[model samples]
Target chain A: MADEQTTLPPDDPVRFYQVGSFAVGNRLQPLDLRTVQAAQDRPNALTCGHRACQGCGEALGARYALDAAVRATDGRLVSVNATGCLEVFSTPFPETSWRIAWLHSLFGNAPAVATGMAAGLRALGKSDVRVVAQGGDGGTVDIGFGCLSGMFERNDDVLYICYDNEAYMNTGVQRSGATPPAARTQTTQAVGPEPGNVFGQGKDVPRIAMAHEIPYVATATVADLHDLEGKVNTAMGIRGARYLHILVPCPLGWGSASKDTIAVARAATQCGLFPVFEARDGEVVASTPIRRLTPVDDYLRMQKRFAHLFAPARRDDVIDRLQAMADRNIRRYGLLEEAAR
Target chain B: MPVQIEGSQAVARAVAACRPGVICAYPISPQTHIVEGLSALVKSGELPGCEFVNVESEFAAMSTAIGASAVGARAYTATASQGLLFMVEAVYNASGLGLPIVMTVANRAIGAPINIWNDHSDTMSQRDSGWLQLYAETNQEAADLHVQAFRIAEQISLPVMVCMDGFILTHAMEVVEVPTPEQVARFLPPFHPRQVVDPDDPVSIGAMVGPEAFTEVRYLAHHRQMEALEVIPRVADEFREVFGRDSGGLVRPYRCDDAETVVIALGSVLGTLKDVVDERRARGERIGVLGITSFRPFPRDQVRDVLWNASRFISLEKAFSVGIGGIVSSQVRASLIGHPITNSTVVAGLGGRPITKASLHAMLDRSARDELEYLEFLDLDRALVQREIARTRVGTRSGPAAENMLRDLGAVRSTPH
Candidate 1:
């Protein structure tokens, strides 16, 4: 088996085990090669015992990303958070789950705050300490967009992470700029001629960050722990402004089962609804290929947000349009492996 | 050594001497020259170890300062009327978080007619924002107050806003004794933040304080301001010993002793008020001018003590509460709850109309005769206002009041819409 694996090409897709590269940890892999989440001494930047809902993807994604960041910087990290679900849940007045230096300034100023943190640290002659700003989709793509763009434009030494949960979950699942088309949010009610969010709305913040020609920009999902951790590690390794957009499925917002958060996020990427890729200086450097192709219906049917499209009658017209979106992403990002294609 | 310099440049030099670690700049009228001066200093390497950020907006400028100050950097920023209104949220946040940031407010009128002129409306609008406000009466005071502002802010862990009239002070050139860096360093110690974002010691700074402890947090903020009532005068005294200048205090009582009536005011208007008082005193009128330097933590006791012998006092306000009479007079009334003192509110210099000696003399003469209205507008055009009111009553569509008034004054060509 070892000899056969050795003979395989570097880009070969075939693997001996069922889990293959999908598993976070493998006995055959070296300790350094294992994912940061699977490590024994991984810094639990967002430690347990917080007010996050069961199977909360933002909590999980933040832990994976921030832990990796802390590791990359050798435990020297200060995070500035915009007011959102992550901030509201993690630090409730006198209690906090954060293990690293964390700051929650306002709903729309995290990026600028992080920029100031970096500048402050540099001015204080503490160049080794790094800054990481974080916020939910509502905070990042909507209210915090200008500050984020400004931070990127200035090439500030800070890493900004956006945990895209599609809607404003903390505010009871209101439609946000990161909400997908035709998704049922509180603001985008499921009772209209064209039920749920309208098409041709919302923003693609990762692409916007890339447009700044920043040093680094990447998109990840909570389902891919290794990829998310690796992306954060890569981001922390760079100096200038870095953006990481991680798709964190909100079980409450999406009306998916608590245990299905990871599966839902998996379906999002595998179905090509969200293209996981990395870019450098306005150019795509790499993209994660889909291990298994999943249909858009399989992804949509799992969430009650999209249940309106399936029930009352299957709106195949809307479903087909969503499928087209997935196909476009698949083609654009080259998300399918050659063998799978 | 006193050198002839613009007020903004003098302030910028004083601020630089304090050695702020970070200075965020977002250009707005009047406040622009102050930040521009600092930016030049940063560029020239005269201000070493300072990160001068040219931010996108006033909101970002204040936000950046909040972050910088939270991370143990002595942060500074400047803004004006509309700019101050824009960053009002972060202004409250900085004070609530107890970050000792020093800001220069180039006082300008808040506008619907969009006038970029000097007034007390900007800082007056943020009176309850938990920031200690010090109004500068002169270019020299504007420069010296900044040095005292940083010390007072850091000592109490509350933000301080040093307010100077926008174009009147910011654009006006005068002989200002900008303190040396050595003098500033001696007065203002290295920033030792009460709470900071440190890797070795991690603590959440701005948290989601619910109703359980929210009131306590706010009460503590108010408590800190009350504490500042003592710190302000003490720091001013310390500054006097170190810098050899009495630049800032709760109130500067000019010729108030044994006076029957005191003219109370804030900002550069006090300079004119002082001149008016002197002229009136020369005419055998027992009148005095009390300049309020520390407007916030309102200096209630000192104001009451100074006005103890006085029978009446007039609050000459540049900004009033629109529907209500006076912003500062209300506080003055509150201070003299049962002191048998007659209080009046004189709203003057709305949208930067000149508060000249002639207008002051006329207003004071009326006050001395006890014929002035309880709430009066100094030099207001009553005929123009009556005409506009009559026109609005006659026609449903009276056009915009500002436009009609401007046309009446022949400031702009009247085009029928």
Candidate 2:
């Protein structure tokens, strides 16, 4: 698995400037072509030495987004964080893991707080100081949804980023508003008849965010650093109520290998389970074509949260149901380049 | 100049005078009129440079205040009853982060039975929210307190809640000396927050506090609130000097000296209590009244000092701690430690129940004779409660007690659900 390349066709046109043909970094790329991450002073926004699990997708996702945001704003981004795994793990008393200006308010009020910060800056005539508010799936999709929606509806000048890890990862992997169907969370256990999470529930925040008719709404994953950074930069480029949702895989919550976070995230997007695209004013402007589509198990089989469906008689019915979801997303977003194929 | 205006209008005017930068408002009744007036002022270009945000909910209202205040914009908002409860988390956040946000709480009863009138339950529920609480004795005081709330909150970098009785104060027009903008400007200078969300100096304003610093941070907030005990009186005195009125203070003791019976209370109920006390004074009964201006810093020592010589004191309050008796009474008891004065608690005006002058007269006369119970509810229908108690004992299931009471009183026009 370690030696394998991405499960995409060679002619997919998704080029990677790899390090030693294995690692992702700036080794031979030209200065401007390279990501801000490859720069000498790339604003190590969530700096090193703080506590984040090994191969944490959220950590990578935040690093990409904030660096791009910091670059876009020219070091004038005051980030308001919602209390979750990212805030808890990155910062602990008297010590912080953030390089840029950051604030960690309560879980559900990040958007409103960011709104306030934007209003504050507006009032204080500090328009240069752009506001970026970030939170986990629980914070963004569930608890903080009202504030987020208010921020969107008000068209507040904020780039709200939701690091979607599917469940309440920090608080023992509880089911959240963004938890995928047929997934086992602490709250939605595997012992139930229908087991895991129910299908008809959970919010499609990217779509809901689009419904707000906000200036910008986009979805990205840590597996695609360039896409993630590109979306963040695009969001920062806009002025009012922008949202960038990143599906960052949690090894701890998902019960997957710490080293396999990026792989899992990549599989989720590639499997068409999590659509990667951008939208403006409630209309879909672009969808990242699925270079290669795989069964939902290609993503779920790696995570232990979905291990129940695999072992003790495979739940093919559930798997087919999930695969149908992926297919629906594929068809809806036109994720496959069928004509090109 | 003095003008007759509703408490809400007065507050709106005072808030305008304070020159609030961001006003995130949601219309909850009684609290509605204040924002209405402010919105009108903003629309008419009278309140310029203010961002009149029409938020969807009370939570957003407070969150907007938190955001606006965090960025060094003077923020203001208003709520009452369940609206206050809805934004309880943001209420704590505003004070916890030490954002100098000034909010007007048209104090209303929180509900299970759906009350929309005056009570202290709203603010009482937020007693430990790390905010400075001020209750107004009159519509005039309610209006004037906003001017002082901004100054005090900014000075300490903590949020302030100026509470006035919902509907009663908010609706009732009174002769209030609405201070001119110049006078308000002289009293409350531009908000100079101690800390702000500045990109130039990027300090993480609200960091995740772990075991190590969480206690110290909380203690620091507690210490700041203690400092408010001193700052409250000074701010009120300074307010009086500038505004030409003795309105805002920790406690306003009227004829308490050489008194045998003193009555202490919060909000506009004190005016009625004061009238009763003055009547008793004319009858040569040693009685007085003390209005608690600042409820949260409790004003314990001032209350203790002023009521020192009284033979007995009664805490007539709008809300109680349910099974624990009086909310303010419990604090009053904790404050009057060394004194051996006989004290009683009059838990009145709950769930929008009115506290009338006749009832206060009877309650005060009972307290004068030391015949008042340790805890009493003013104008309570004991017959209804007793009937319910007896019905429960005898196995009568008439649904819930409130419904049963309504049925017992012949007020129910429809079938019990």
Q: What DockQ score does model 2 reach against the true complex?
A: 0.63
Give the runs in model 2 whose Cα sits over 4 Å from its true position.
A1-31, A338-341, B412-417
- Model 1 regions more than 4 Å off: A1-21, A337-341, B413-417
Q: lDDT per residue, candidate 1, A1-341, as tens digits?
A: 13222233557555545664466234455555567766678788999889999999999999999999999999888989999999999988688999999999899999999988988998999989999999999899999888898899999999999999999999899999888999999999999689999998459999889999999999999888887988998999999999999999999999999999999999999999999999999888899898889889999999999999988899999999999999999998899866422
Per-model TM-score versus the true fold: 0.97, 0.95
Predictions' DockQ, in order: 0.80, 0.63
| Per-residue lDDT over B1-417 for candidate 1, one digit per residue giving the tens place of the 0 to 100 score | 989999999999999999999999999998899999999999999988999998898899999999899899999999999999999989999999999999999999888978788888999999999999999999999999999999999999999999999989999999988999999878988989999999989888888988998899999999988999999999889989998878898999999998999999998888888888888899999999899999988999999999999998999998989787799999988888988988789999988889999998998888888888889999989999998999999958989998889888877532322
> Cα lDDT of model 1 overall?
0.91
The residue-by-residue lDDT of candidate 2 on A1-341, one tens digit each, is: 13333343547454653532233454444454468887787888888887888878899999889999999889988988999989988878578888888887788999988888888787677888999999999999899998889889999999999999999989899999899998899899999678899888469999999999998999999887877887888888899999999999998889989988888988898899999888999988888887777889889999988988988889999999889989999998889975421
- Model 2, chain B only, scores a TM-score of 0.96
